[model samples]
Target: MALSLLTPNSLTKIPLTKLRFVPSLSPPPPPPPRAASVSFRRLSIMSSSNGIKVGAAQMTSTNDLDANFNTCSRLVQEAAAEGVKLLCFPETFSFVGMKAGESLQIAEPLDGPTMRRYCSLARDSNIWLSLGGFQEKGPDDAHLYNTHVLVDNYGNIKNIYRKIHLFDVDVPGNMTYKESDFTTAGTDIVAEDSPIGRLGLTVCYDLRFPELYQQLRFQHNAQILLVPSAFTKVTGEAHWEILLRARAIETQCYVIAAAQAGKHNEKRESYGDSLIIDPWGKILARLPDRLSTGIAIADIDLSIVDAVRTRMPISEHKRLESCQKISSLSSL
Candidate 1:
């Protein structure tokens, strides 16, 4: 039936089934603001069954082990309260010493008192944790290993990654670090499973090497990449965020970077901009700058990672032989 509208001057008839309603041409209203510093999608995937809540925490660690422990404890509590299932802390989190020699004094066995306390905290809080950058005592007393550990919700040590690439660079005016002098490089690359997804572990200086991240993603099928760093003021300002985003985009996975911020001691300062970047290289949550210290929680959707890789299919297109040839040529 046709509906007819009668006006003072005229009458119009329109069939309901044939008539179309057009929307206003004005642009749609802007999205509602978020409480988190910045959320890429503004979609809260937190409570989604397949989505996991993760937090990356930045720190200003010092020579005092006790003080550092207190700082970490507080951060963990805060994250746990926010329902962050996995909490990641910065490099040298156990203790960043004043002198390189002090690392020798504090470097402990994997089962040391500090580690035991960490286990207790993770278990009691019911949160999985990225306990990054512990000074691990090496055998024969020759060198210490900078270790990154993933603790399960039960507080069990799931995986341990000793940093392979030592930062031996001499950045002019900003900082000069000789990590090789005090630390031994790790031989094996570690990629292991967690409650969230297949987690790949690397530390500070490892960020410069894209090959490590690539292998972790393609070779080991890592869905999340961990980069807990104590980045220097110079390089971090210029390279940190971009490098992290590049890795995430290249790997088609999540990049969670918990960093050391502010001055640790009289000798050193770290550029702090701890970030959580999505597979598409969007900054989901970031601390903004080096002076900030806190945990930033974001939802991790593994499906997004799958979708990106499935669509782009870059992994299938990687040329290993050609890359190796280029590497050989560069060396020669």
Candidate 2:
């Protein structure tokens, strides 16, 4: 199925029969009056013999490392206490610098003290964590990699996916931000099996590119797609939910988007509506307030992935020429 074919109207057309939220997990607090409200369709979920609980977090991170970790620790504990096996955090979960050179100044190796702290937190909490958009020290001194790290319940580093697409857009009327200035783009596409399901990893800007996601679903056989983003308020308001739902609908996979919300510094602000959507394009959960710091919890049932795929069979029907074109175009 072509991603372009899936639209806002398509979201309303999907047939839904059984809607279920995890019984033990409570919904997140209501968003403030000022935040834009998103009405999620609480429709049916496919029956599953077993499912894994996951949490997608939203937070406003600053240059203060300790403070950010404190918030992460608190959220990790909360998710763990609720029997969540995996908890995903947003981009710049550790520290969002106030100045331009700040991230470059503090970029760390994957095994550095900063990562060690998060790894230890995962061990202590006994929960798997998806630490999105860590500023990892790159091959050259001038650049860093916007790396995503996945830590297992045992606190071991399981997988890492550096962001392949960089945000270098000049939004009309809005400011121009060039991620490539400081961060190097990653070359490899990554996915790995987990307790939840086969996971496809991508960062913020990558969400705008559906071919990468097609490769993950068609080639990597990913059952869930993770988008950890620090999206600009301008774009997030217009495109975040629409693009996320489109991806889920097209791929027949669960999408867990942990986003940075609210104002981080004078120059940086994120559109924060952390969401977890099911394979049927139904939003399992989201924090209504786009700028609140919290986690949206949902159950990832692989059965739903199977059911959706069996019903639509897009993977089976995808044109061979289209698949070839997507492969050739995104190979770089």
Candidate 3:
């Protein structure tokens, strides 16, 4: 079970000069470079009762920050043209440093230049963005936080979630990645309201834990779950779609997954199959090519979420059973 070698594919780069971004209205001045508290900013267009269009982007990111930004900018324009209100990006969207200590060397705070450009892009495009798995500078110099940022259409920082489940696996003769070596685990579970619905934020490794998804649905009342990942080819082929569909069915929530695809570097490659699954475990959208750089477009309807939950009514049943078990234990 040796690690398989992947040949890097040449992706067509869309020049920023050719693309156009038309804001719906005048965008406000850029906010100060500081991390804003967790809050939701609703846009007038997002408040409509109809279903909202969203996009999940898949791309191969490298150590070059400028190139990655260009790729993302192009996707934003394409999504906006298709009337997408929200677009989600994959983990490590900015830079994927293959070497040790490289990410820490370039890690920036929330208010850093890297984030400023993304904020400006969102404002100019007038589209909400979910930037998952940014290497954020931590409290100390030795470590960094794998941060996920949600920005509003107006370029406001809505909320941020650091990845709590650090990937520390050592499969003999296969893949061995120790994410905890350089990254610090996040302490909080973050959820926020958006144009689509109540969004539950979780990064790559968080997908393996069902309890996290259950907490998001039962406790946080999250209607949509976002899983941004860079899954290895082996594991992704085995469980990616199955786990995503299972989470959607059990939670009765929409699941949108943005993924990193193709060979990023000689030593690293990702299994890319970006998907958007509905509450009923149906795949609404997915990229035709598993290893291409593009977005999966879909419409998120809250009405469908309600319809599925109403028919199944699993949440209520689970609560009732828990209460009964507690009452029985007390009597004993």
Candidate 4:
């Protein structure tokens, strides 16, 4: 029996009786008095109703797919060990710095090998996971999409959001990313019911578009916004934290951003600074540059979304009356 490729199902079939079964039968301790299992009614009353702990994982990955998977697995395990209900990883975590047309070679079917691996990890750790920008093979194999997927503790995929806004910028002296050259943009916005709360999903460059977040927060009632980014060091230094905090303050939603930080492929440098921000625009936990792989755990109190909105009443203040003038002018 080869131990390397054995699965749980395969291991279960081998009879234990066929193998040596050593038993310590020295008068098994007198059966302890049976204890009644607590009813669901009692358990619900004792659990906290308002808060859930979530984690953001920062991964520094290279072109090696196996190494990247292993690193992500370890970080997820660390987060699960710390009792985090959900964990998120940075963008393009599986393969970074691959040339223009090279991603196609690595792209997998939505239910293919990569997802199976992720599903297994999610079930084993019993933690919800969101990995940024998996290379997903499109319909008919015409194009590949940079897709973000959410998996529940049961290893079931809850939602998939392809990168709605591709990175088509060409910055002088810094970086030039023309994602549109290889990938097609996704049209739909994805918001899903998660264990923590309603979650709105976005990838790296999509963070720049405020309208997306606005629609997600106001229309969809998203409580948490997940941004898995691989921002360049130049832009990240300038706008990463500020933009993340601004989104939290504007939407009144907890922002969990896991970013890639440091140099990769002997050329490109990513701005790390993975952060977890509260609805009040306060930084709860942050992983600074060069931290590599780690978890940023934060208590996400969904109540804060209401509390801040109630105190400020901004959402209500944007009444039809205020927008009427703008609408009337546009109509004319």
RMSD (CA, angstroms), candidate 4: 17.0
Model 1 / residue 150 / CA error / Å: 1.1
lDDT of 3 at 170: 74
Cα lDDT tens digits for candidate 4, 56-166: 777667777888888888877777777789988889888885465667778888799988999899999999999888989865455789999999999999889999998
Using all chains and alpha carbons, the TM-scores for the candidates as numbered come to 0.82, 0.84, 0.83, 0.81
In Å, residue 251's CA in model 2 sits off its true spot by 0.7
* Better candidate by lDDT, 3 or 4: 3
Q: Which stretches of candidate 4 lie over 4 Å from their true place?
A: 1-50, 139-142, 288-290, 320-332
Mind giving the per-residue lDDT tens digits that candidate 2 earns over 15-117?
Answer: 2234444321343354565444322222123233366778898888999999899889988887888788999999999999998899999999998999999
Candidate ranking (TM-score, best to worst): 2, 3, 1, 4
- After TM-score superposition, the amount by which residue 29's alpha carbon in candidate 1 deviates from its true location, in angstroms, is 27
Give residue 69's error in model 4 in angstroms. 0.6
Report the C-alpha displacement of residue 55, candidate 2, in angstroms. 0.4
Worst 10 residues of 3 by lDDT: 38-47
What CA root-mean-square deviation does each model show from the true structure?
A: 12.0, 7.1, 13.4, 17.0
Predicted structure with the largest lDDT when compared to the true one: 2
Q: Model 1 shows how many backbone clashes?
A: 0
TM-score of 2: 0.84
lDDT of each: 0.78, 0.82, 0.81, 0.75
The clash numbers for all candidates, in the given order, read 0, 5, 0, 0
Best by TM-score: 2
